[model samples]
Target: MARLTALAGGLAVALVLLAAPAMAHNHPSGITDLVTPAVVRVEATAHVDITLLDHIGELVHVERSYDVPIGSGTGIVINPEGGIVTLTRVVKTDRDVAVYAANRVFAEHHKVKIPADFARHKLKDDVLNHHLQECYPPKTPTATCIINVTTNITVFPNVSPADPKGLKADLVKAGDTLDSPAVLTLSGRVLGSLGMPTAPLADKVPDAAGSPTNVAGFLGRPAPNLPFTVDIAHLRQGGGGDSQGRQFADPEKKVDEPVKLGKLIDEGFLGAPVIGDKDGHVVGMLFGGGQDGRMIGVREITAALAKAGVAPRRGAIDSAFEAALTRYHTKYYTEAASGFQRVLELYPGNVVAAGLLKISLQKRGTAEDAGTKGAVSPTPRSLPLWPFIVAAAVLLVAALVGAFLLWRRRAPEERVEEPPAPVATASPQQPFDEGANPTVVVRRSQPFQVVPRQQPLMTANEQPSVKYCTECGMRLGPAHRFCGYCGHPIET
Candidate 1:
């Protein structure tokens, strides 16, 4: 029974041991941790020649537009090729693209305009189409606005921004295009000029991730970090709860998904990439602010860029990372931990993976303690010493408890009884002739008498016979009629 108990206890302990490793697995990125790195702050400064009053109140023309900052908004890198997608309102000629990639800020980038189709709203007889050209900047040449234009829709990705790879794109096909309302449509160029009708957007293909069904085919796939959702206030410090930065402000026209948000950002965040909380996938490029803010979805953005002769792809690292993310979402912590470790190995600078791995390790202990979870992997070749120690402790406790109960059960039998008090009696006869009063005496108890096993003595309580001698308390044989000690008389 003792052996069986030990065996059962060890088995239970082993099961308990399995839970620690699982608990140690990595944690998935939460809403805040995932999105912080990918987000970028875009600052565009432009000079517009303006007519202004001089210090003496005389009319004067200023060549530099330094005082007026051209455009301020947000943008996110959409493709590995360095294609940055933002609201078109932020980009203009003479505008400088300053990007804040986390802490590493890049001062200047070539501004490129995304390809979009705009429908110009015009009245009869060619009156001023004031309503249709809202996207066009004030400096856009009037001669180029010969054609009426209205709505603008994102149909393709701008394959080029200032190339982070330091490669300049070769010129492609050039022609006039009325597609964009912001452009001088009649001349197929900005300000009625002829050349590439759009800003140089296509330079090279973005690194494409293989199809979701066939992830293994891709080579050197880039792993996008998991994304998060945070309150607009959390991103900035010391703005009122209700008030936010203009860049993060809600747009006047809110449209549809791909860019749908729980709450609108200030104006600065308008063009920021809306990343998914799950896989860190770019859901859309944010724009618009009506009832529903609009975003260009990943598929549509990439697909349009594909039509526009730009390659769009996801990297292998992204695939692996996303698989790990799936495991984490399903609570397969052990696998997720391994996955996150792999990501860190691939890219040590990946903060999201590191954070997640730390969380996984911390949760593993808790899960193991709860007994509801255990490790998924096989046991290691060498067991940890802790398990053995735990088992030994458990067994020791069991032994101690058993000993205590056994002692309690045998206590009565082991107890010693006081022998009956001795009666007064005359001394052996030393003082009988000296006028001695009856001498009193106390006798010590005799040693316990033992009958050998071979002798086969019956217990006094078991036998009905009065076998003990009443006189002098001597042992008596069953057939004896006389006391053996003190010569006391006895009846058979």
Candidate 2:
């Protein structure tokens, strides 16, 4: 039980150590990679189909179609089901596409010089100029041109092997302002059942000014040669207001932060997600361009998503990726490899996963791979014989010592049995009985004096036969020197 407890304690410590590296760092070391996979390039095009009516000696009907690119920017996937969040200006344009289409159509059909622009144009001919004015808007029956305009929004994801055609998406919700958050839903087929990778949105913006952040997006269509760009910046004070939008701060003045972001915004990062340095989550979206660049906070993004009836959430791909990331950072390459492989199977061409998986595969089973170390064996080990040997020796010694003690305890109580004592007979001896008889003379002389002399008598009870103990007054055998009942000595 003691060994088991120690083993458990060691395992707990190992787990804590393994998880430490991922939790220790608060800065954005490489966290920008976390959001780059979900970044996508958004392009909006205006499709116009126009019909021109030219009345002349011969009535000719001319129909033509024109594709005009109105807007291009970056966006982020918010959910696994292909829900996207971007700026309204990236998918919706305010220009009069109808007029642009009419201008091109008229120029081609009439073989006349007409500036192909959104503004209304005039012709020297009164009738043609009148027709062009009528084509502007609010269709009238007398108008000489019929035009229909539609916008097509396409999304190119950051994946390998570059999807040349890109996925089709439709605007689901748009904010009040051109730079406000807009929601788009993919109309194309999903890449996988688990859907695409999504960027995590922070619960709230960092309250302090000069908060560090990274802006990630594609400056062009996502491709093998064209990688997503990530730029570091700091947030200015007082973000997310009706008019103040959010501004970038350059404390050191080493670089014009706004101008730097503005240049990227102009290229394609207009709606790029601004990732927070603290936790690598989307705190806001980049907005505006040129000398003054701004951002829209996550609150506005969520609000727009709410209005679109969509919830921002993660999916299976994210779940697998995060699990793998922990193992990778902990140097458990064997386990990490399997986890990364699972992620790749779920979503192929995942750049981060691919890179980590490659490293994991190389490091797996090596000494540094923690997952491969300290593995429990299935077979039980054979215990050493020395302990049992020592135990047996101790038991034998104890038995011998116990036996010797038992013999010593009984030694004093054992006494020898003595032989019986011999009985004694009383006898009298005669004096001078060896010589011849010559003593009769004296006897005659003395006989006359036989006067009355008293003789003492003896009784039968006076015979000397038995002995008694002086201490207890108990009878004793004739040969006994000590009393059997009281252990008293007898004097002869």
Question: Residues 1-492, candidate 1, lDDT per residue (tens digit)?
Answer: 455557666766776676555445444432333333233334433322322212223333322122234443444433334334444454332322111110011001112222222222233322222322322333344321122211211111111121122212211111121110011011111111111111112222122221110000001112233122233211111222111211122222333321333234333445555444334344444544443344434444444454446444444445556666566655556777888888666544454567677777665545422222564433343245566667666776776677668778986766444333223343342212222111112223444443321222445554434455576665544434454333344554
- Per-model TM values vs. the true structure: 0.33, 0.70
Q: By summed lDDT, which 10 consecutive residues of candidate 1 come out lowest?
A: 211-220
Once fitted onto the true fold, the runs of candidate 2 whose alpha carbons sit more than 4 angstroms away are: 1-30, 362-492
Predicted structure with the largest lDDT when compared to the true one: 2
Which stretches of candidate 1 lie above 4 Å from their native place? 1-39, 47-68, 93-263, 273-283, 290-292, 297-300, 368-492
lDDT of candidate 2 over 74-160, digit per residue (tens): 999999989999999998888888988888888887788999898888899987787678767768988778888888999998877
